[model samples]
Target: MISATELPSTRPYLIRALYDWCSENGFTPYVAVKVDASVQVPREYVQGGEIVLNVSMDATSSLKLGNDFIEFKARFGGKPRDIMVPIQRVMAIYARENGQGMAFPVNDDEVSSTPLTAVQPEPVQSLPEDDPTPTSPSPSRPALKRIK
Candidate 1:
């Protein structure tokens, strides 16, 4: 049995919570992903080794946000395509309107196996503008808090 001390990663839970929050608040949810060999997405649309996708219900069909991966069918340039992204590859998920989102730190092991010398950093797309203005957190809006 798993002990309370050995908890699972909170990334997947946070993703689901944020996705639901965006949906309830009428905000378009978007996910930024780091592209690699394992990721299957439209290469032409990939910029700077990453791809930003709209995972809203209207934007995708048969969307499945699983703990290991997020799968969905979205149209690119009017052509339907299936997109698969590993949860570890998700850089951030945020509301497109207000830019309210959380960014995850990349683990060293998650880095590409290719040597740094041979790797070329692609121009990654920047996240939406985060409003620095402070706002009170309500029960309706999820916020990341650290417990000591």
Candidate 2:
């Protein structure tokens, strides 16, 4: 089992890679479970929604998680459960011969190519063309008072 701390400081890219693979290969594998349940998310991510996975390779029927632990089950060939795997324990993903599997390897030097940025975009300003003309505010007239 590889703790997140044991992995490189970079976010484990396995999740993103799996998402892309499923999309391209017509597999409906989804994150199914988020690492941070406390993180605020749009209603769509939780309401009537099961992460909308790309389930082409194997059909995941259920997911479970515990303290520092995560697990899931997948179905195949019309069977209720064809595979049982853990999230953190998964290293390499393999879907072959109508089945899905995971590998656990201990390597911490793999570089995640995603870039982190600290600079934010500046607000845009609309400037008037240099016509060198000044505009004045409109003036109102005073009401006439009756002299007694």
Candidate 3:
């Protein structure tokens, strides 16, 4: 018999499912990623040590949402750049329009967020105007908040 620890994590699967949901519902899919050395993205666009990516079909090309990594080519500031993010590094996946999504546990040395049942709303800074990768509009983005 296999131990529970040996079981595969549902993170990647959930990520793919949410992506599909957003795509089918005409919602723009965005992923909040915790940046570190392992994450490959434009450093200039990162804010508060995190970056939100627009993974919608219209935003990315050659996008591959894999079990271990999400690979894609996107344009930032009119320059094409290759973006890669580890599955575990994704802190949250939510729709840019409705602000509904899931938050995942991030095991980071500098910062950490506990797993939650659903996303909570909070004010977050907007992304740079010139940067192609952007967070949700209206200064509002899904946030991970502890509910007691």
In terms of lDDT, the best-performing candidate is: 3
Question: Which stretches in model 1 have alpha-carbon errors above 4 Å?
Answer: 1-6, 111-148
Global Cα lDDT for candidate 2: 0.35
What does candidate 3's lDDT look like per residue over 22-84, in tens digits? Answer: 999999989999898889999999888889999999999999998778999999999999999
Off by over 4 Å in 3: 110-148
lDDT of 1 at 126: 48
Name the TM-score of candidate 2. Answer: 0.27
Count of steric clashes across candidates, in order? 2, 8, 0
Model 3 lowest lDDT segment of ten: 110-119
TM accuracy, model 3: 0.75
**lDDT for each residue of candidate 2 in 15-130, tens digit (9 for 90 to 100):** 44654565477554433322123222233434332122223434444443332233445433344432322243223333332334333331223222222212223444544788
Point to the candidate with the largest TM-score. Answer: 3
In order of TM-score, best first, we have 3, 1, 2
Of 1 and 3, the candidate ahead on lDDT is 3
Off by over 4 Å in 2: 1-12, 27-58, 63-70, 76-84, 95-104, 107-148
Winner on lDDT between 2 and 3 is: 3
